[model samples]
Target: MAKYHRIIMNGESYYREYRYGSDSYGEMLSEEELVHMLLEEVVDEEIEISEREIESALRRIPDREDRYLLQNYIRCLERVGRE
Candidate 1:
């Protein structure tokens, strides 16, 4: 079987993304984290995303602070699924 691991959690992500297979995946977002990410990505209308589509939306955000915050949320959310 392919091995998957959690690198970090609770709003702590060491990189911009994580993947174990063909598609990109990340962790869940807190209510505040969701609001923050939406605020950051509001300028873009071209991104087609779904569900816990946190990281994809985040990549479009030019601000490192917003990316970092959302990345952390991804780590937390993804970790739960893998665990």
Candidate 2:
């Protein structure tokens, strides 16, 4: 039989399916590992959102603090996407 693990991290839930196999096949990933995987997946997905969309959204912000925060966020996203 197969097993499924459900984990919630940063307000998002992820499900991992594990198939039964020989002893040397593979081991189940830890919760931290799952969370890291989920975060990476999210980053990859957010990176795919159009740059124009992000710029348009950033331009809508009226607060200087919020704009700076968003700009820094976009920079971080770009850096991560490049890796």
Candidate 3:
């Protein structure tokens, strides 16, 4: 069975999901510790693409208007970070 545990630390409330058998031997973690553990689970990879392949893909964009629109959208995002 699964259980929901609510922890209040430094006036902030945080919830953790605990699976009985799986987490039985584990100690509860503080909010920052839990965040760090979650981040450590992410895998980062690097991919390489050829210049010819990049040009070919860009060529498939159909029209200059669409390309310009995409460029404008990218510029707007650079000016303002995602909310």
Candidate 4:
């Protein structure tokens, strides 16, 4: 079974703590995993992103790689919204 983790998202730090699995991808999950799996999945599914969304995400993430990922996700969300 998959284990759940709790993470803080009070407008500051955000991170995922994988539970019920080893850091190496095979160990059992820790009891207090940090990955906010539920919120992440829900937000990803529900957000109807657009070009504006991409821009917003870019603004949120300063790192180039992270901005790329967020923009890609926003594009996918825009496509899903159009569909």
Q: What lDDT does each candidate get?
A: 0.62, 0.71, 0.68, 0.56
For candidate 4, the 10 contiguous residues with the lowest summed lDDT are 24-33
Query: Quick one: ranking by TM-score, best first?
Result: 3, 2, 4, 1
lDDT by residue for model 2 (29-72), tens: 66677667657766644435787998898999999899999899
TM-score per prediction, in order, is: 0.32, 0.42, 0.43, 0.32
- Compared with the true structure, what per-residue lDDT tens digits does model 1 show for residues 1-83? 22233344666643223475666656654555655665676665566647556556788899999899888887898799898
Task: State the local distance difference test value for candidate 2.
Answer: 0.71
Scored by Cα lDDT, where does model 1 land? 0.62
Q: Give the per-residue lDDT of model 4 (tens digit) for 3-75.
A: 4333445544443345544552333333333344445555645655476765775788879898888778867
Best by lDDT: 2
Assess candidate 3 and give its lDDT. 0.68
Clashing pairs in 2: none
Which runs of model 3 end up more than 4 angstroms from their true locations?
1-4, 9-17, 22-25, 43-67, 76-80
Misplaced by over 4 Å in model 1 are 1-54
Sliding window of 10 residues with minimal summed lDDT for model 1: 1-10
